[model samples]
Target chain A: MAKQERAIRTRRAILEAAGAVFDEHGYMSTTIAMVLERAEVTKGALYFHFASKEALARAVLDEQVPFGAVPPQPCKLQEIVDMTFVVGQRLLYNSLLRGSVRLAVDQETPSGIDHGAPFRQWAQALTRLLELARDRGELLPTVKPSETVELLVGSFTGIQLMSRALTDRADLADRLAVMWAHILPSIAVPGLLPGLDARADRGARVLASLEERAAS
Target chain B: MAKQERAIRTRRAILEAAGAVFDEHGYMSTTIAMVLERAEVTKGALYFHFASKEALARAVLDEQVPFGAVPPQPCKLQEIVDMTFVVGQRLLYNSLLRGSVRLAVDQETPSGIDHGAPFRQWAQALTRLLELARDRGELLPTVKPSETVELLVGSFTGIQLMSRALTDRADLADRLAVMWAHILPSIAVPGLLPGLDARADRGARVLASLEERAAS
Candidate 1:
C-alpha cells in the first residue's frame, strides 16, 4: 500500500510537471526532458510512469475533466452553471486544464492520439446535465439538449481562447458569465430564467466553497 | 500602366500562394521557398513584396478584414448577421482568410506582430454595427454594443472552430445560423425578432448577390 501511494505521488508530480511545460511551450515543442527536469525524477522513474511524450500529453488531456466536489443543487441548471464557474476557476490556476486545452487546440499535435476525447467528454457531461434539466422542466420545450451541449462547449472554448489571448484568461469567469447570460435566456423556461445565477463572482465563490469543504 | 498592372498581379499571386502554403503548413512550418515555388515568382520578387515570412503573415492577416460590397439594409442587426454569413461563405473558399485565422491563433508566431489585430478589428466592426442597431432601435435596451460585440465575435469564432474540426467547416453556415438564433432573442427587440432572417442558406445567397452586383 505504501509503495502504491509513493508510486501515485510520483506519477502526479510527473503529470503536474508535464502540464506546466506543455502549457508554456505547447504540445509540439514540449520535450520529456523538460518535464523530467521540472519533475526532478530520475529518467528510469519517468519512463516507469510514461513511455513517451505523447503518453504524457494524453495523461494531461485526461486530467482536464475534473470531478468537482460541489454538492448538487435542486436546479440542475444551477449545477451546470456552477460546473462552468468551478472549471473556469480551475482553468485560471490549473496548469493541467490549461495544457490540455492548448494541446487539444494545437493542430501540430500528432494525429494518432485522440485529442478530441476531452471535448467529447465535456459535451457528454453537459448533455447529461441538460437531460436532467429537461426532466425537471428547467429547459424550454424548444431547446435541444444535444445542440445546447455543442453550443455551450464551443462557445466556452471560444470565450476561453479569446480570454487567453486578450488577458491570459484573467477574465475567463466574467466572459463566461456574459456567454451564459446571452444563452440561458433563450433556452431556459421563462419562469426559471430569473433565478439562474450567471455571475462572474460565482466562480470565486464556488472555488472558495470547494476549498472550504475540502478543508472541513 | 502595364508595368504597374503586372506588379499588382505579381503581388496578388505571391499573396495567394503564401496563403495556401500557410493554410496547409501553418505559419511556423511554412517557408518562403514554398511560397516562391507555388507563386512561380523569383525569390527577389517575393522578397521585394514581402520582406519576411512574418511580413507575409501580416499581409494575410490584413487581407482578412474585407470591405463587403453588400449594400445597407434597413436593419443594422440584419447587416451584422449578413456580414457573418458573407464571411463564412468567403471562408469556405478563401485561403487568405483561412491562413490569416490560423496564423492569428498560432502561438509560435513571433510576438512582435499584433496577432490580436484581426480579432480586435472584428470586434470593432461588430461594435460599430451594434451601435447602428441601437440607433435604429433594433437592439434591446439592455444590450450593450461593446459587450455584444465581444460575445458575437467570440461565439462566431467558436462555432466556426467546432464546424471546422467536426465537419471541415461544411456546416459552418448552419452552425452560425444556430448561433444567431440563440443570441438574437436576448439582444434583439421583441418586435424586430420576427423579421430577422437567420437562415443557413443566407450566406450563399448573399455571396451570389454580391457577385451579380459586381458583374453588373
Candidate 2:
C-alpha cells in the first residue's frame, strides 16, 4: 500500500509537470525533456508509466478535465455553471498552464484521432445537467436540452477565446459570472445559479478591468 | 500610380503566401524561406514589401479579416451572422491557413502590444450594427448591446473551435447556418433571418455525416 501511494504521487507530479509545460509551450513545442526537468524525474520513469508522447498528452488532458461522474448533489444548473466557471477560471489564470490550454485548443487533432467521443461527452454532461434542471420544473418547457447545451458550451469557449486573445482580462471569472448572471435567466430558472459569489465577482471585475483598459 | 499598383500587387501576393504557409506548418513552425518558396517570390521581393515576419503576419491577418469597411447593404443582424458563418467556413477550409490561425490566436502578445484596440474596434462595429438593427426595429429594444456583442463574437469562435475539434464536420458552413437558424430567431426580429436557407440545409447534411462518423 505504501509503495502504491508513492507511485501515485509520482504519477500525479509527472502529470502536473507535463500539463504545466504543455500549457506554456503547447504540445508540439513542449519536449519530454522539459516535463522530466520540471518533475525532476527520469525518462525511464516517464516511459515506464506512459509508453508514448501521445498517450502522455491524452493522460494530461484527461487528468486536467473533470470528465468522470460529476459529484451528485443538490445543486441547480446555475450552480453547475458557476462551478464550471470557477474551475475553468482557475485553470486559465495559472501562468504556467494558460499557454498549454491555448496550445491544446489551437492544436489541430492529428489525422485519425477521433475527438468526437470526448466532445460528445462534454456535450452530454451539459445536456444531462440541463435535463435535471428541466425535470425539476426549474426551466421553461420550450428550452431544448440540445440547444441549451450548444449555447452554454459554445458561449463559454467563445468568451475564453476572446479572453485568450486579450490577455489583460485575467479576471475572466467575473466576466463569466456576468455572462451567466444575464444569460442564464434566458434559458434556466431564475436564481438557480446563485448571484456572483465572491469568486465569480472577481472574474467579473477582471473583465471590467480589461474593458476599462480597452476603452482608455 | 502604375508603379504603386505594382507594389500593391506584390504585397497582396506576399500576404496570400504568408497565410498559406502559416496555415500549413503552424505559426511557430513556419519560416520566411517556406513562404517565399510557396509565393514563388525572391527574398528581395518579399523584403521590399514586409519589413519582417511579424509585419507579414499582421498583414496576413488584416488582409484575411474584412475590417477596413463595413458592408454597404442594409442587412439584418441575422444576415450578418450568416455572412460571418460563410466567411469563417471558407477561411478554415484552407488547410494551409488553418494551422497558422491556431498559432496566431495562441501567440503571446509581447509587453505593451495593446492588442485590445482591434478587438474593441470589432466590438464597436458589432455594437453599431446592433444599434442600427434596433433603429430599424429589427431587434428587441431590451437587448443589451454589450452582452449581444459578447455573445455574437463568442458563439462564432465557439463554432470554429468545435468544428476544428470535430474534423469530419467538414461542412462547417452548413452547421453554422443551422446554428444561426436556431439562435437568430431567439434574438432577432421575427421573419428577419428567415428559415435555414438551402445553403444551410446542405450544411446540416454535412454535419450529419460527421456526426454519424463520430457516433459510429
Candidate 3:
C-alpha cells in the first residue's frame, strides 16, 4: 500500500479512537496514553498526527457536522427537518459526532479551544436553511430566521442532552420528532405541516435514502 | 451570635464560596483549598461541615432552585413563564444558582455524583405546572402536557446554555421572553396569549413583588 494511503488510514483510526475516549472521560481526565492504547499506535504515530490531548480534543470537537447529502425536498422546511433527524440518527452511532457534542456543551474544555464554535456553526447552518424557507414563502409571517435558529439550535442541544441523560439517546429521533411537532406550528406555514415528514424514523429513512443514492 | 446561628452562617458561607469556585473551575479542577480560601474559613472549619470536595459539590448542585415565591397569577401558564424568567434573571446574579447550573450540565463531574438529577427535577417541576394549565383550560385543546413539558424543560436548558455561551447570560431574560413568545402560541389558548406576562422584565417584577409582599 502507498505510504500516503496508510498514513491517511492511521490518522482516521487515531481520531476515531480519540473521540470515544474523550466522550467517556472528557477532556481533563482523558490522557494521551489512553488514546494511544485505543488506537493501537505508538506515541510517535500519535504525535505525528496530533501534538497533545488538547489538540486531539480540538480535532474531535470539530467533527460534529458530518458531510453527507440528505436527499433534498421541494420544501426547504423538509430539508431542515431531515438535516436535524440525520444528525439525531448519526449521534446514535457516530463517536466523532458524539464526542464533539459532549465537548461543545461540556463545562470543561482545554484552554485556548473555542468550545462554543459548534453552537455558532449550527446556528449559521440552520439560519441559511430557514432563510431559504422564508424566501420560498413557506414560513409564517411572524417567523424570524435569527430567533428561530437560536431556538432550534439551543433546543436541539437541550433535547439531545435530555434524551441522553434519560434514555441514552435511544429515543433521540422520537425526541426530535416531538421538538419539530411543537416548533413547526410556529415556524412553517399551516399548509405545510401535514406534508412535512417529521417522525421518529426520519433519521433511519434519511440514512437509508443516502445509502440507496450512493449505491445507484 | 448564638452558637447554632453562627454555625448556620458559616455553613452558608462555605457553600457560597465553594459554588463560585466550582463555577469557575468545574468539578474536577476545583480543589478544596481553593474553596476554603474563597470562603475564608479554616480547613478544620470546612471539614466540620463538609467531608470532601465531592460532598461540597453535591451540596452546591442541590441549590439550583432558590426558595422565593412568584406571586400567584390567574393563569398557570403565566406562572410557568415567570418561573423560567426568574431563574434566568437569578442565574445572572446568584453564585450558588450559577454554580449548580454549571455543575448540573458539566461534562466532568466528580466520582459518585448524580449530575442528571437536576434535569429530572426540572422536568417534574414543569410537568406538574403544565398539567395544571391543561386542567384549567389555559392550554390549547391539542396540547399534550407530557410532551410539551419535556420540550419546555429541554428547550429552556438549551436556550440558557446558548444565551450563556453567546452573551454570558446577560441577555437571558430577553432570550426567555423570545422563547415564551414562540412557545406560547402553540401551548396557550389564543385568548390567553394577549394577557400572558411573558416578557424580559417579568423576572425582575416577580422578584420585586415578592419583596414588596414581604415588606407589607
What DockQ, on C-alphas, does every prediction get? 0.64, 0.30, 0.68
Please give, for residues B1-216, the per-residue lDDT of candidate 2 as tens digits: 699898887777777778777765665677899989888888999998888777776655544345223233466464456445545645555543453344445444322333343445556777877778778878765577776676566566666666666654464565465455445655666666464342554433444454687799
**Cα-based lDDT at residue A49, candidate 3:** 93
Q: Candidate 3 — which residues are off by over 4 angstroms?
A: A1-4, A42-44, A67-69, B42-45, B67-69, B212-216
TM-score of each: 0.94, 0.78, 0.92
Check candidate 3 and list the clashing pairs: none
Candidate 1 docking category? medium
* Candidate 1 ranges with C-alpha deviation above 4 Å: A67-69, B67-71
Tell me, by TM-score, which candidate is best. Answer: 1
Please give the range of 10 consecutive residues that has the lowest summed lDDT in model 1 chain A.
A63-72
> Comparing to the true complex, what docking class would candidate 3 get?
medium
State each model's CA lDDT, in order: 0.83, 0.60, 0.84
Per-residue accuracy of model 1 over B103-187 as CA lDDT, tens digit each:
7766655667777788888898779888998998888898989988888877877777777766778988888888888899999
- Interface RMSD for candidates 1 onward, in order: 1.3, 3.4, 1.3
Candidate 2 displacement at residue B4 in angstroms:
2.8
